[model samples]
Target: MSQADHRSPQDHEHTVHYDGPSGGWGSLRGIARIFGKEWATPAALETLARQNKPKGFMCVSCSWAKPADYHTFEFCENGAKATLWELTTLRCTPDFFAQHTVVELLTWNDYDLEQQGRLTHPLRYDPESDKYQPCSWEEAFHAIGAELRRLDPTSVIFYSSGRASLETSYLYALFARAYGNNNLPDSSNMCHETTSVALKKVIGAGVGTVVFDDLKNCDAMFFFGQNTGSNSPRFLHPLQDAAKRGVPIVTFNPVREKGLIAFTNPQNPAEMLTGSETPISTQYHQVRLGGDIAVMLGICKHVFAADDAAKAEGKRVLDVPFIEQHTQGFGDFEAKVRGTSWSEIEAKSGLSQGAIERAAEIYVKADRVIGVYGMGLTQHVHGFENVAMFVNMLLLKGNIGRDGTGISPVRGHSNVQGQRTVGISEKPELVPLDKIAEQFGFDPPRDKGMNTVEACEGILSGKVKAFFGLGGNFVRAIPEREAMERAWRKMDLTVQIATKLNRSHLVNGRTAYLLPCRGRTEQDMQASGPQAVSMEDTFSCIQGSIGLRKPASEHLKSEVDIVASLAEATLPPNPRLKWREWVDNYALIRDLIAQTYPDEFHDFNERMFTPGGFYRGNAARERIWKTTSGKAEFTVPDTLDAAGFDDAPGRYRLLTMRSNDQFNTTIYGFSDRLRGIEGTRQVLLMNPDDIAKAGLQEGQMVSLISDAQDGIHREAGPLKVTPFSLPAGCVGSYYPEMNPLMPLSHHDQQSKTPAAKSIAVRLKI
Candidate 1:
C-alpha cells in the first residue's frame, strides 16, 4: 500500500515551504533571532564586525578561504551564530555543576548541554559525589600529569579539534611526541580523510590545489555531495557573483539544496531591497547516493567516446599531450571505463545515458574547471575510490595544475586544514620528525599513532586508558555512541580543554577534568603582550588571527598557555625546549615551527600579517607532483558501487546530514531553516516514492535497523518520516543523532572515515 493511502489529510498541514532564496530575508531573520536570543550586547556586535577582518580573529565556523579583497562584513549567518554562541553571557559555573549531577546531565540532549553555557573555571569530576567540583588550575594539572606519568604513553590518546591555532597544534603534537608516542587522532579523521588519503597518493599533495583567485576566475565550477548553504555559506557569495558573470555552476546531489540553486546576498543593498535572487547553478543533477563513482565512470566513458569520434574527424577533445606529459595510468583508466557497461552505469548512477552525456559536454567545453566536494563523497566504504575517481575525471581534460582550475575540498572547521599542516596527524611521516627532534633536543616517536577509529577501538577494549581532548566533544562526535559512552567511564583518565560544557564532560571517566580555555573571539593576553596566532584556511592561506575583545571569563587561559603548562606538569623539564618562553611569546613558537618545516613555514612570522595572509603554495599548482612516479596518476576503481551494499528487498541507503542550525556535533538550534524543518530534529527525509514503497505514511514514526554485515545490532529510533525529493533508494537524517546506526567497523578501507553517508538500513513501524 502507498503511504498516501494510510495518511490522513492533515499530515502536512504544518509544513511551510521556503520559497525565498538562500540568503535573503531568511538569513537576516536567522541572524537577528540568534542576536535577540543571546541578548546581543555592544561587545558581541563589535566582535561580529571585526570577524574575518585584518588583524581580527577568523570565524570559528567553516574553513572557507578568505577573499583577497576585504568586505565590510565577512561573516555569514552561521558564522554569526558561532560567534554569538561563544560570546553569550550565560555561564556553566561550578555552581551549575554542583547543582546537577553527572548522572542527571547525561539525560540532557547535546543542544541543552552546550546551551547551559561556557565553562568558567577548571573542574574536577568527583565520581563518589557524582558532581564536578571547582579545582585550582595547578591542582588539575598536577593530577592530570601524575595520571599521564602512571600510564604508558602509547595507551594515551591526544585528540585535537580544528578550532586551535597552528602554533597551539604544533606544541600539542610536540608534547605528545615528547611524552613518547604519536597517538594523535583529530577531527579530520571523521570528515575529509579520504581527500587527504586519495589526493596525496595521486597528486602528491593531500590538500586542495585551488586558491580564492582560481575559484573566482574559473570558467566553470562543479560541486558534488556538498551543501554550501549550511556547511560554509561564505562560499555562496562567490557562487552568486559567478552566476551573475554567466559562469556555468553545476551541482550533483540527491537533495536539491537551496544554496546551490539561488542566493540573495544579504550584504548587497540592491539584493535586500528586491526579493529577487541570482540563480546559482546552471544545471543540477540529482545523482543517487553512493553513485558518485559510477557517475564519474559514465562521464569518462562519454568523454572517451567523444574523443574517438573527434579523432576520426581530425579534431581533438581530450588533452592528449598534457595527459601524456603530466599524468600516469591514463591507458589503464580508459580501459576500465570502456569495460564498464552502459546498463550497469545507468543502473548504478540512477541517471540516463543522455544525462551523463550532457555533464560530459559541460566538462569538454570548459577550458578551466574547479571541482568542489565535501564529506558526502568521503564518508563511505569506498570513499578513497570516490575521491580518486573525481581526480581521474579532471585529469582527462587536464583540469588541474592550471590557472583557474583544481580541486577544492570545502573543509568544515576553521583550522582543520591548518591542524593537519602543523602536524596533528597519526602518521608520523607526514611531518618532519628529524627536524623536530633536532630543534627540540629529543627523539620524537617514529611509530604510526592511532587514528580516531583505532583510538575508539582501543578505548572500547580497555587498552587505551587516557583521553585528552584539546577542543571538541570527542565521545559524542564519533560512531558507536552507546558502546563508546559505556566504555568511556571505564577509562583511567579523561581531560577536555574546552570553552563550554558538553556531553563529553558528562560522560566522565574515573578521573576527569574540564579545563576552561579562551575562545577565538576573545583576547588572549600573555606575559609578553597582546598576541596573534596563525591559521591556515581551506586553500592553504596562512593568516594571523588576533582576538580584540575581553574574554568571557578572566579565569580562562589561552590554549597555548594551557598546553604549555600541562606539558610542564607532565614531562620533566627540558632546557632546550623552553615551554614557558614559548607561551610567554608566541613568536618563539613560530620560529621553532619555521625551523621544523623550513620548506613550508620559512618566514612564517613575517608573511602572517600580510593582508588576507600569504599562500602556503601548493606543489601541485606548479605541476610538481610529489608522488613516487613524479607525475599525477589516474586511479581505477575495482567496483562501480563504492559502498558495496547488498541489494536486499527491504533496504535503503541512508546518508547522514547536518541541519542549518548545526556544525559538526554542536547543535545551535532545533530548526533547519533551509529545509523548512523546525521545533525538532528527530525526523527522517525520504523520497515520497520510497515512503510509499515501505508502506509508511508521511509523518509516521519509525525506527531504522542497520544492514551492516557486522554481528552487532545497531538502531536509531522513533524518527518521523517526512516526504522529500531524494532518490528512490536513499534517505537523509541529521548526523551524530544517526551516528548510533554506524558501526565503528563500517568505515573506508583506506581512510578509515566513518561510512555515515552510505549506510544500508531497513525502516520499521
Candidate 2:
C-alpha cells in the first residue's frame, strides 16, 4: 500500500488545543477558510443568507430543525461549508476525466477527488479507454434501462442519500417500485435505522417526537452519544439558549465534545463583544463506548429506587397515572432493571454509581425532559436496544406526548427522515406500498428488500446486478470497504446521480454512468416553471426548499427530472402515472404523496411553503401507540454489554467519528478543530493509560486489527495514536477511514444497521 493509503501526516509540530468556545471567532474563521478554498463569490454569500429562511432552501449539512422564528443568520458554520461547497465554481468536465484514468483517479484521496468539483454532463465508462467519456442523457438512460430490463428487479439496488429533496425521493421510490422491486436501501441504513426500528416497535412512530419549539420549552435535556459540535452545529444554538435560560442539560458521551461543554453564539452581539461562552452541559459524563444502554439502565434503576422511597413519604415520584393509561410492559421492564446489579453497570459503563445516580437525580428533579441522541447511540450491534432503553428512561416519568418532553434522534443528512417518510425503505410494511399500488396501478414488490449490508452481500455473491445511487457515496460510506470495492466492480451496472465527483464514481462496474444533477441551492426549471422540493427535518417538519442560484451547468437536471426520465426509460408507460407531467410539475408528485400518506402529507403542496412549512405530525407525540400492543411498550435489554463484545485483554472498542470538516464520508478538510487534531484524519484518540498500557506513546504509528471471529482479517493503519479524554477500553478514529476495520456481518440483527461505532479492535505496533 502507498504511504498515503495508511498514514496521515500532521500539519502542525504538535496537537493544537483550541481553547476558544465553539462557534465564536473560530466558526467565522472556518467559514472564511472554506469560502476562500472554494473561491466562493459575493453571490454565494447572498445565497447563503437565504438558507433555512422561510422561502429559501434547507441547509444540506444536518437534519436539525429550522426554527419558525428565523434568525438574521440561520445557517451555522458547517451549513456555510455545505452551501459554499455546492456553490463552488469548479467543474469536473470531460477534459478532467480524460486527463485521469479510472485507475489514476482511484489513487486520489476522497477530499481531492471531490475537490475536482461538480460534474457538468452525463458520462459513461469506456473499458477500452479506461476513462469516463461525455454522453447524452438519453444515451445514459437508455443504457441503464436496457441493463435493468435484462436483470431481475430484485437484483437491482436503488440506493439514495439524504441530500435528495422529498419530491425527488418520493419519485425515486415510485420509479424503483414501478420498475418492480423495493430494493430501496438509503443513507439511513448506515446511521439511524436503529432509531426507526426501535422507536416504531415501542411507540409506533419511526421519527423523533419533538419539534423545534420543544427545545425552547424543555425544562431539562438529556443528551447521549451525540456530538453536536461536529454532526449538527445548528443544534448548539438551542443548547446555548437553553443553557442561558438555566435549563439543566445533562450529557453522556465517550468524547468530551467541545460543543456540549460550552458554546459562544456568534450571532449574539453581547457574547461576541464580551468574549463570554455559555456552559451547555450541566453534567457531562464520558461513558464507555457502546455502554449507553448500561448507563441508561443504571439511571432507570436509580429512578425506580427513588420512586420506592418517595412512595413511603406519600409523594409519588413516577408518573403512575400517565404510565398506567398510556403504557404497557412497565412491570416486566422495571423487574429487569431492578434485577440488574450496579456492579455490572459500572463495569460495563466505565462510570461510577455516583455518576449514574447523579444523572438520575437530575432526571427525577425535572418535571419535563427531552432525551436527545445521535448515531453514537444508533450505530451498534444493540443500537435498536440502545434507543429502546433511552425511550424507557423517558417513559418512566411520562416524558412522551407532552410539551417540553420527547425523544429526538438527531439525524445526519438534511432530508434523511423525509426520504423514509416519502417511502424509501427495504421493509414494505414501513411504507404505504398497497396505497402506492392502488394509486399508481402497479403491484409493488412485497418481499423484504436489501438494506446496505444485505445489498453489499448480494453484490459480493453476484446476486445483485445493478446499483442506482440517487445521491450518496455508497461504496465509501458502507462497511467492509475492501470487500465492497471488489464486489462493486463486478456488478453489471452502476448509475450514480450526483452533483460532484466522489470515490464511488471511480469504482466503476461493467456498465457505469454518471448523470450530473442540480444542487439544492440551484434553480430547477422545468416545463411548468421554477420548481421547489420539500424536505423533512428531524423534528418531523416538512418544509419546501427552493433554489435561489443559477444552475451549475445548463446540461444539469433536477433529481426529480432525472428520476422521472430514468423511470420513463426503464418502465413501460403507466396510464395512471404521468412521468412527464410529474417531472414538469413537482406539485403533482406532492399530490400523489398526499394521496398515499394522507395523514402526513394532506394538502402537501398547499402547506409546503407555508412559512417554516408544516409538521407531518408524529402519532407517538399524540400518545397514540401504533404498535401491536396498542400502548407504548418498555423494552428490556438482554445484557449490559449491549454489543456482546468479548472481554478480551488489551481489546479496545473502536468508535468511528466524523471530524468537524466532514459530513458523512465527504471530507471537507484535514483539520478537526474541536479535538485538537490537525492535518490528519488517520490519528486514533485513546486514553493515556490505555496507550501506556499497550506500550504505545502518543503520536506513535500503529495498525488497528479487528478482533472479529470472521475468517477475513480486517485491518486499518498506520494510524497515529493521540492520547485524549476517552475511556480506558475505547479508542476514537475518523469514519470511512476506519470502516475497513468493521466487518459487514457485524451489525444490529434487528435493524441490520452496521455497528460502526463499536467495532472490537487491538493495536499492533
Candidate 3:
C-alpha cells in the first residue's frame, strides 16, 4: 500500500526528507540505500538507463545546460531520480479525482497529494460538487477571463516560479501588463531579492558580478552557506579546478556539508573506480546561523591589519597602484574595520579569534578572490547587509572588474535569471517602462509595485483582490503557509497556471481555475512551428533549450499560448503589448528584449543560434560601475549586537533546508543518507548534549510548536528524535513541511526573504 493510505491528519506535519550518500561522506550508505534498500523499486533507474541513450537535451532545473554530446549516465543521481519519478508507472488520472473532493485533497499529505502523477486534463473547482471536475483548456481560460474582467487591472497580482522559460516569462509579463497589473510576486522574493536589491544599490545592475570562466583564474574563494555538491553537482567541476590550482576556498556555515569536504565527480573514471574524491574546502569554519555579519567583519579586519603590517614592513600591498586608481571610500571603510574589535566579532560570530584570523590570512594572501553566496546569506533578517559586506571586501583589494575576483550569487533555479531579463520584476528602471509604453501604447505606471512581503500584507488587509500564479506553487513556497492560505481565501479569485496538481491547487478562492500547461521536459510548439525556449545561467549567459519529451497531454497548451489567450481576453479590446504578434513569433519577443535591454542583448537573433549561451554585460570588467559617484563605494555596517540571540529556553532557532534528492519544492524520493536520516519526514536535528539535557533519547517521539499559533502550520506529533553536532541552540528540518512553522514576519528586513535559518520554537515530549 502507498503511504497515503496509512497516514493520519498529523502525518502532514513538518516533512523530514532524507538524502542518502551516493559519493560523498555517506558514500557507502548512499550506494547501499539506492542499490540495496531501494533496489526492489527499479522503475526510475530503469527509465534513466533507457533515456541515457544520447539524447542531446539540457537539464531544465539546473545550470548544466551544455550540448548533450556524451549522454552516458551524464545525469546526476537526483536528476535521474527526478526523471524516474516523472516517468513513474503511477498515474493520477481523472478517475482518481472523481472520488476525491478539493477539500479531501487539501487534507491529503503533500507527498501523496502530488505523486498522483502528471495532470491529464485541465480542472476547475465546483462548490456544489465539492470536487475538481475535468474541464477543457478553452473553457478554463474563458472562466479565468470572465472572473478577471470584473476587477480593476491593478487588483490582480502575478506570481512566477523559476521553471518558466524566457519566452513564457516574457509572455507572462506582457499578459499581466496588458491586463493592467504590475505586481509580479515571484520566488525571487523568497530567495535572492537581497542579492538583487543590494547589487542594484552598489553595482547598478542586479546580477552576479562574475562569470563561469572566472573560476579558473581565482586564487581564493570565500563561499558561504551553499552546498553545491548535492544541490547542483555541475558547479563541482569549476570548484575542483580551483582546488587543483592551489586556491584556498573558505566555507562558513552552521553545519558542515559533507560535499563541501570532499566530492568525487561521477564523470571521472579514476574517481568512479577508485572512489577518489576531490578535496574542496581548504578552510572550513562553522559560524552560528545569522552571524554572517560578524564573520565577514572579522575577515575584513584581518585583511586590513595585514595591509598595515605589510606597509610597516615595507612590503608591497593592495595592488595599491590599482586601489587608488579604481576605488573610493577605502579610508572610511578601513577606519571602520580597524576601529572594530575582535572581541565583538568573536562574540557575535561564535568563532574564536584564531579561526577568524586564519580566514583573513587566506583572503589577504590571494592575489584574486571571489566571494560566492546562496540562500543562507539571503534568507536572514540582515541578508542585504551580508551581500553588501561581501561587495565591500571585493572593493577593498580592487579585486573586481578583472578575471578572477568578484561576487557570485549561485542562483537556485534555472530561469530566475532569465525571468528578470524578460521583465519579471516589480522594480524596473524607467528605460524599460518607457520602451514598453512606446511599443504597447499604454502609458505604463512608473510607481513601484508590491513585493512578496507587501503582497502578503495587502492580501491579509483586503487591498489586493485576486492572485494569479504563472507557474510556481506560491501558497506552499511562500513564508508562513498558514497565513498565506488565509490571505489566499480573502481574494476575489485565484488562478494557477500549472502542469500537475499540488497542495496549492487545493487552496481554492471564491473561484479557482487550474490551467494545465506543457512541462519543461516536453516540446513547446507555437504558431511559428516548434519553438525553443531560452534561459540565462548564473554567469548571465542566455541559451536556448528544446525539450525532447512528448507532452504529458495533447490538450495542454504552452505557457506562452495561455498568456496570449489571457491577454486577448482581458485587454481593452486592442492590447498594448502587441501580445498577438509576440506569441505568433517568439523571435519577435527576443527582438523586443534586445531593444529593451540593449546593453545586454544587442542582437538577440545572432545570439539565439548558439546553444552554448550569450553572456550579459559586466560592469566590473569594464571598470564602469554605475553607482552615483561613478566608483565602487564601501558602505558602513550597523552597530554590533554581540549578546543578542533569537531563542529562549526549550525554544530552538529552526533552519528549514533541503535534501540531496530534492529541488525547491519537488520530491524525488524520501531519503537523505548523507545525513543518516530515514523512514520519515518528521525528524529534527539537534546537538547531542542538548537532547540529553532535555532528557530526550534517540528515536523518542516529540513535537515542535512555535510560541504563537498565529502562523505555524505544522501538526507534528511526538516523533523519533535524532542528534547531530549542530549549533547548541539550532534545529534543522526539511521544507514545505517546515514552511508552515515559519512566518512572513521572520524575514530579512530589506529582502523580505523568509528567515528559514532563524525561527524560535519549543520542543515537547
lDDT of 2 by residue, 667-745 (tens): 8898889878889888888777787888888888999998997778889989988877777788889889998989888
Q: Rate the local accuracy (lDDT) of all candidates.
A: 0.88, 0.88, 0.72
Q: Candidates 1 and 3: which is better by TM-score?
A: 1
Model 3 is weakest, by summed lDDT over 10 consecutive residues, at 1-10
**Model 1: pairs clashing at backbone N, Cα or C within 3 Å:** none
Q: Of 2 and 3, which scores higher on TM-score?
A: 2
Across residues 493-571, which tens digit of lDDT does each residue of candidate 1 receive? 9999999888888888899999999988888888899889989899899989989878878789999999999999999
Better of 2 and 3 by lDDT: 2
* Residue lDDT tens for model 3, 1-765: 123211211222232222322364343334334444233245435444433222233455665434323334556555554454544445566788789888778887766766776677777878788877888777877778888889887778888888788888877876677667678867888888888888877766688878767788889999887877567666776777777878888888776675666677666778777767767788777777777788888888887778778989898546676668766777887788889888888877878899888888888888889989888788877787888888888777777788887888888777887787778888746238888877777766666667788888888788888888887678878766786787787788888887667888888788888787777666677778777677787778777756656677787788888888887766667544677777777788788777777888888867754644668777766778777777776777774421124546677767778876567787645766556565567778776767888988867888877754464445444556877656667777787677776666877777677777676678877
The candidate with the higher lDDT, 1 or 3, is: 1
Q: Put the candidates in lDDT order, highest first.
A: 2, 1, 3
| Candidate 2 clash pair list | none
